[model samples]
Target: MPPSDAPAPTIRPAAPADLPVLGRLGALLVRVHHDFDPLRFIPATPETERLYAGFLGTQLQEPNVVMLVAERDGEVLGYTYAGVEGNDYMALRGPAGVLYDIVVDPAHRAQGTGRMLLEATLAELAARGAPRVVLSTAERNENAQRLFARAGFRRTMIEMTREVEGDAG
Candidate 1:
């Protein structure tokens, strides 16, 4: 059986010092999930990774965003990002937050890293008066779906996407 009990992960908001580790974790998640879309994955280069990393770094500076990292021994094992999109769940009357992204190192799967990151995020949101939390992931990513479900999240919407060529009217 997989090791389900791991040393408690140290959770904290992302600081400038965490930029590199956050980039590494984000890139790893992208590479791992890219297998689901070869056309999108094939064109990704190291530069692309770095560029996106830089963007994430900047998001840390935005007041509307909260990017968190979980680490131990100088290695980041997980991270989660939350934001207030203004378009919150209408029925909720108090506060609202959205989980934009959450990921854990594959080596740490089933070790509660995802739960650690999520619980921490939810606490932060709750502290801020959030009554409704929301997020979206592809229906095909069953692992993520399961994680969300176990965290007490339920699907309220389905979003479909289509690609269009440039210069479409």
Candidate 2:
């Protein structure tokens, strides 16, 4: 039993039936990214929902992927996805896990939902034999950075991008 003041969120693997909420939350994440960097992320469009649905559906089928949802009283508060990757190239040496995406609805912020989702994902990846885990967030996304840092993830790489003025694609 949880404290009387706060309810505990149920964390579990996401199912096909959860697609609708996942799509909505995915769109919210995309919008947030776009807001953080207009040049780097695409804004929500008529096709955005469809694209997110397909992406989530495909990820759910991948054996190396872990997708989880956090819900309280049957209302989904957030979700997360991670995947195991093999290092075929010289840069990375062994099998690693990538914390691909995690999003907690704005209304549900300040709760432990994000942390719960992260811990669950990390445990799943570790159980799968991934020696290390990595994740990235938008440069301006301080909240996400803080969450990752609190989870013991350290800075390992910095990605810098510049637009070529003369190149129009």
What C-alpha lDDT, on a 0 to 100 scale, does residue 110 get in candidate 1? 77
TM-score per prediction, in order, is: 0.80, 0.92
Q: Model 1 clash pairs?
A: 95-130
- What lDDT tens digits, residue by residue, belong to model 1 across residues 51-132? 6578788898887687888887677777898975564356443356888789887776777778889999988887766777
| Residue 138, model 2, lDDT | 89
- Encode model 2's per-residue lDDT on 84-146: one tens digit a residue: 999847545567998888998887887888999999999999999899998889899999999
lDDT of all predictions: 0.76, 0.88
CA lDDT of 115 in candidate 1?
A: 88
Q: How much does candidate 1 score in TM-score?
A: 0.80
Report residue 38 deviation for candidate 2 (angstroms).
Answer: 0.7
lDDT of 2: 0.88
